[model samples]
Target: MFPLFAARWDRSDLTASLTLFTGLMALAFCLVHLFVGQLRFLDRNPRSRWLSFSGGVAVAYVFLHMLPELGANAGAFHRATGLDEVMAESAVYLLALFGVAAFYGTERALKRSRGQDKDQIEQARPESSVFWLHIAVSSLLMFVIGYLLNHREDTSLIGLALYFFAMILHFVTADFGTRGDHPELYDDRGRWILSAATLAGWLLGTQLSVPEIAIGGLFAFVSGAIVLVVLKEELPEERKSFFLPFAGGTLLYAALVLSEQALSA
Candidate 1:
């Protein structure tokens, strides 16, 4: 009886440790956007190599980890939803495509807003309505990220750490881009709202339980958004981003991920 009780206590302690780690990671996610405005060094004509490096890391995670996970999750999604195998298999990818399209549409609208507003010529901020629309979408993404802090399929510490690093870098790049687009508004209200959305997501995840299929779908959407946002930030001609750092980051992360998989296998 004492041995059984000791085993139960050990399991309880492990659960507590994991819960604390996830909560702290969620807080870090909230803090990244809340204070990302201070990273003014990234705002340069000759673009920051760090941003390119971050983009590379994000791309690596999406392609190597998240996309493969989506494929693996497809079978479970099919089983849960009672849909045809083909439709269920393809559903997550369709959600990912929609995520890309949604962000692209918002990007075009922001550009249009800037172009039409001659009065705000110097600042080049998007109009107020458009700014909120962009913020809403961005915040939704943040919320999903925060929710996944708890719901992520990999409950191990190493898995959570990798997720945290990939996402924190992605957040920095995203915050930089949005802050540039809405210079006045992002710092004033946008970052605060995003930070809150992240916290809100964590709170919801703690309080409410959702189906695994729904969580998988949200994960796929975020994977798509991350890919689009990273490319949009890096691929602009005027940014003059570096290639070496980007390649280095990609190779380094890929090697680490592959090694991790090998060790686990």
Candidate 2:
């Protein structure tokens, strides 16, 4: 449902409502998967299933929640000021999708490069430098996208940047720590970078005044860090197994949803 132009942007109540709706939808999606585990049918492999379910929820949010709101708001905005919402909204979605695709693509590439056959690698490798590279590329893409949006004068660009950077850095840090071949010296460096990234995210989010997105980003960062820490201790033998990657995928999905919220906000 779209709102009508009233000759000026009123921050359409409908847009605001949609933002809240999408946020709730994202939270619900995560909680339901965490608790009910109904989507296990989507994939036979447990880890793959988790990644798919999480990714599915994120994709749904984009199509069902974010895109709809953009269409509605864009319609109203265009009617009132002769601006094109379709192109703007499309750009946002394209950038978001590109980030996700890049992460997955890079991950797949890494798995292949590691002498892993497609099926075996999916179950075997958990944490790898290639995987972390995927995260870094995806994160960097978010920053680029944010810069583009800001250059275009998108009001929510700053919030979007904060949200994307937080999650991206979280993944990057986790990946860095989990790399099986990482030099011991790099561990401390990785941790320091992660700490700085988290602090920077917090400060940026605060300065930008997007509390909701900030909280979401922090949640992702904390969750990722906890996963990496636990994995470092528990899976010493199979440090490169599917466990960590699965968790990373979940975090990436969270980041996507948060980015959507920030952009829409």
Candidate 3:
């Protein structure tokens, strides 16, 4: 699909044009959840299946694209920062590790504060402090995603397209899970606010001129954030999931990513 449009990828104007599309898509992703009840077929029995499938694609993307990119970026980060060779090579992984730990720690703290298993929390539970915490972190992550979509000029158009597709589904799954937990609280205003944050981030990224090292760090952080989010949503023991859909999503996106890498290589 990307190949068919390869020749049309005009570098000078492509990012500018696509930024608008990405922003609109991000906004739409958040808005879609308001109609969740009407979209039962996509959210029905074995509710975690959709999340699992999207999570699988997201995980595959992090492993196949982000990790390698970060590995390469770490060498540059080391050189730029004048660090010891070994330390420089480890920069990306260290940042990613902290990202993972931060997310895990946040979840643990939120759960402990509530004194109840989040996985078992019913819709009737008041939007606890944990709810606002989730909103804040999710907003931050969404903003980073919006920023990345516009700022990653190193990625070819096709690469961004694939990432966009996976992330859109990822957002869908995540938002659905969020709405489930805060049925009455995650209202239209709240949804619009989340969506606005994304657009604001995208607009800001377009105007900013950050360095390569900073961008690399952003990718590492987002990779960790994405991993925790998808896994947490899809892997709880109480949730029913379809393995075939999960595996199929994983393999399908993996194949696409591999093909893209092969062509570039």
Name the lDDT of candidate 3. 0.71
115, model 3: CA deviation in Å?
3.8
Ranking by lDDT: 1, 3, 2
Tens-place lDDT digits, model 3, residues 149-256? 765644565676787778877877777777666666676445665777777777787677477788788878888877887787778766676778788889989998
Off by over 4 Å in 2: 1-60, 72-85, 123-129, 138-198, 208-265
Candidate 1 positional error at 115, Å: 0.7
Name the candidate that leads on lDDT. 1
What lDDT score is found at residue 72 in candidate 2? 44
Please give the CA lDDT of all the candidate structures. 0.80, 0.38, 0.71
Cα RMSD of all models vs. native, in order, equals 4.8, 12.8, 3.1
Clashes of each: 0, 3, 0
Q: Write the per-residue lDDT of candidate 2 for residues 29-147, one digit (tens) a residue.
A: 22321223233342232234333333333333334333444344444344544547776445434444544454456645655765656546534553556645644553343333222
Give the Cα-based TM-score of candidate 1 against the true structure: 0.89
Better of 2 and 3 by lDDT: 3
lDDT of 1 by residue, 123-142 (tens): 67678899899999999998
What's the candidate order when arranged by decreasing TM-score?
1, 3, 2
